[model samples]
Target: MDTATASKNPDTRSATDRGLPWAEIDTVLFDMDGTLLDLHFDNRYWRELIPDEYARLHAHEPELARQRLFAEMERIRGQLRWYCLDHWVRFTGLDLLALKVRLERHIALHPHALDVLDTLRVQGKRLVLVTNAHPEVYAFKHARTGLGNHLHRVVSAHALDCAKEEGCFWERLQTVERYDPQRSLLVDDNLAALASARAAGVEHLRGVRYPDSRGPAMQSVDFHLLESLAELLPDRRLHAYASSPV
Candidate 1:
């Protein structure tokens, strides 16, 4: 069926169709860390580097320090404090911002991420990055990768004073970005965040199954998955988009 015909009549499409109605969607809300950039850098930073640094700085045994840190992290997994670098600096007495900058070489974008961003831009979609990463973290990654250049706007959940996993985040986000939930799509790796967006009336959502290249691809029980952003744009002309610098 023709694109126009299929877009107009949903009944005409096959049951197995995984295609999104781009004509119906105007705003695309993206999660920065895992959705656009590789999540391995974060996993390693929090799980390995921070623990080692904490042990070194506080004179605690390495294993015990990691264990203590993991427990604290689990305690606030979905809360705003979990994603706050300042909170960690105070909790661990370590200069986390400096450490993050030191490990800047590890930061990177996921496969086909640039192509997807450029394609969405060409489609005239209002791309907004809605991330839980602290502004400092986002600022560094933005400077490193120029991901912000392709986006129309970037909204950190920190600005909204809540984590994306919180149900209120979507509503609070609307105050800064007037995106229609019915005509918007949110792409994130966190299932909890996706659930919160759904609860806030977002009609479309997508999850990245392979946010951490080093880890096994994950499965989402509640949402369709994209192993790579390439799945979002299948146009053969995307080769041109991919060649464009971020």
Candidate 2:
């Protein structure tokens, strides 16, 4: 799926119909933040709350405070201890998760992302949400999106007890959901997460860059960049079932 197909027309190629040549990816593994859900909340959590707290603690300019904190956080983003928000809070003496939640309260879903999931389910594709969010944050996101009822299962990287950067995290995912990797497709906004899945042998993976992002765009995954899930739905032929009335 090219960027053109993202807003132009449906590819008319279901994972199998495209002659994907894999075992038939009946299972579609979806990432929550930035993939299905918009990254606005997470971005705000870091860009706002973290900075405000840092300024309060250090008595510095908010921008300088945030930049300093972000610099430190980025240095260890892929580290095991970093994924554990509590661990970071303990290490920094700041309530990381609590601060994150304050910002997360404003998160929302990308246009038509959930509609694609509904179409997938209606098409008989097994749906599973694979994310790195902790249980509390996960609940907040799901409730806000009204998507919990549309999925078959939700698996978090935390549940796997590891960060998605690790190969073992992908390997462990196999145990939670019995899906053929060759046939399975993983979608995420994080390049590392996509690479980890590809390394685990899931062939039809995609990375959706935030449409208006100013950060490092994820290009490590295959080039199927989608800005909206509406791109995957069938045309008027299945419009009624695939999307909300326009």
Candidate 3:
């Protein structure tokens, strides 16, 4: 059965499958950090190591350092600088990127992320890595994950001069990477970015319910949530990966 027709029929398997309708999607925009790679590295870096190190350097109580840093982060939470490592270095007087690179051992792909990308690549999908990460951060993660090899293009918000949380990001993204919003799908863990995509007319959105495997459950309330990218695969491939040695 055709995709649209299959989606309409309650008895059709497509209705039961949570995977994207590949036939209808042309370009697949993926969020690199939490959506593809495990988010724990960033979480631990920002929430744990940074705080501990900052407290050590500044001679402040551990709790005070975390509280101070959290307040500073809140002030620029959804802005581009929030993702800027240079800005963080200047603000915190810390060599953030070097610290991140040192923590690269913790960087890893989410389960089945590679398999899903392999399937999409062979199908000739336009896979784009769209991220709010600063270029330095992107480079480090790329070194660890080799995500650049699999993507048609890698876009950093710094290059666009806008964060994904902002609505204009989609328009700016098109200036460099042309895509039909209605025929595109974005798998992102950030709710703000998903909302921005929806507002910009992107047709499909999937949110990661557990972006940080080492952390608690995340909120993906307005958009469809996937427990893992494994859910994006067809039953046959999913079972194969599950049974295969990790």
Q: Best candidate, lDDT-wise?
A: 1
Tell how far residue 12 is off in model 3, in angstroms: 17
Candidate 1 lDDT by residue in tens digits, 157-227: 89999999999899999899999999999999999999999999999889987788777777866788764
**How well is each residue in 171-220 modelled by candidate 3, as lDDT tens digits?**
99999999999999999999999999999999988888778877776764
lDDT of 2 by residue, 1-246 (tens): 232234344554447443332236678888887878777677777666666777788775766766777787888786655656666566557877567566655676766677778877887788889878777678866766676788999887888887787898888887888888877888777777778888888877777756324345445334566545565554445444324432
User: What C-alpha lDDT does candidate 1 achieve relative to the native structure?
Assistant: 0.82
Find the number of clashing residue pairs for candidate 2.
1
Clashing residue pairs in all predictions, respectively, total: 0, 1, 0
- Model 2 whole-model lDDT (C-alpha atoms): 0.69
The reply for model 1, stretches above 4 Å from the true place, is 1-17, 234-246
Q: How do all models score by TM-score?
A: 0.88, 0.79, 0.88
Sorted by TM-score, highest first, which candidate order results?
3, 1, 2
Alpha carbon lDDT of residue 60, candidate 3? 49
lDDT of each: 0.82, 0.69, 0.81
